[model samples]
Target: MVQEIDKLTDNVNDIKSLFRTLNETLESIEKRLSRLEKMDSIEHRVEVNQIDLSDIKESLQRIEETHSNEIQHINRRLDSHLVKIAKIEEEMIIIKSR
Candidate 1:
């Protein structure tokens, strides 16, 4: 009877050790899952920021294009006005001589 009791006690101790190992493994898995969740959140925020930056770049490019076009138009108008003034001055000189 004593031998049987010793065997039972050994089996109980083995079961307890197995339980402890399983609990440790579960805790490790939980920590890893938490870390993954945090990484995912950070990645999502980075993606959103990237999209916002891209939109800002596109808006700046459009503004630059508009300003360039406006400058070219203004330069053309100035050139046209200068040419008209020169022609008017020549006409005045001829009239004054007569």
Candidate 2:
């Protein structure tokens, strides 16, 4: 009878050890899953940020093009005025000689 009791006790201890190992494994899996979830959230935010930056870059490029066009227009107007002034100066000199 004593031998039978010893065998049962050993079986119970083995079962307890198995239960402890299983619990530890479950806890480790939960921790890994939480880390993966956080990584996914971070990746999504990065993608969103990249999209926003692209939009901003496109807007800035458009503004730069508009400013360049305006500058060209002003330069053309200044050139026209300079030509008129030169013509007027030549006419004044011709009249003085006559």
Candidate 3:
């Protein structure tokens, strides 16, 4: 009877050991799944940033075009002012001669 009790105890211990191992395996799997979920989130953010960068590039191009046109217009105005100054200088010189 004592030997039979010992055998039953051994069986119970074996079952407990198997349960612990299974629990550890399940925990490892959960950790791996968490890492995969985090990676997916990072990938989503990267994709969103790529789209935003493209939009920013387009906006910058438009700004450059607008500034270029403004600069051209200013240059033309400056040229006109310079011509007016030259005409006034010529008139002043003639008046001084008299």
Please give, for residues 1-98, the per-residue lDDT of candidate 2 as tens digits.
Answer: 99999999999999999999999999999999999999999999999999999999999999999999999999999999999999999999999999
Model 3: CA > 4 A from native:
1-26
Deviation of model 3 at 72, angstroms: 1.5
Question: Candidate 1 overall Cα lDDT vs. reference?
Answer: 0.99
TM-score, every prediction: 0.69, 0.69, 0.62
Off by over 4 Å in 2: 1-19
Return the clash pairs for model 1, or none: none
TM-score, cand. 2 vs. native: 0.69
Question: Would you list the clashing residue pairs of candidate 3?
Answer: none
**How far in Å is the alpha carbon of 1 misplaced in model 3?**
16
TM-score winner, 2 or 3: 2
Per-residue C-alpha lDDT of model 1 across residues 7-96, encoded as one tens digit per residue: 999999999999999999999999999999999999999999999999999999999999999999999999999999999999999999
Candidate 1 lDDT score at position 38? 100
lDDT of each: 0.99, 0.99, 0.98
Q: After aligning candidate 2 to the native by TM-score, how far in Å is the CA of 68 from where it should be? A: 1.4
Model 3 CA lDDT for position 62: 97
lDDT-better candidate, 1 vs 3? 1
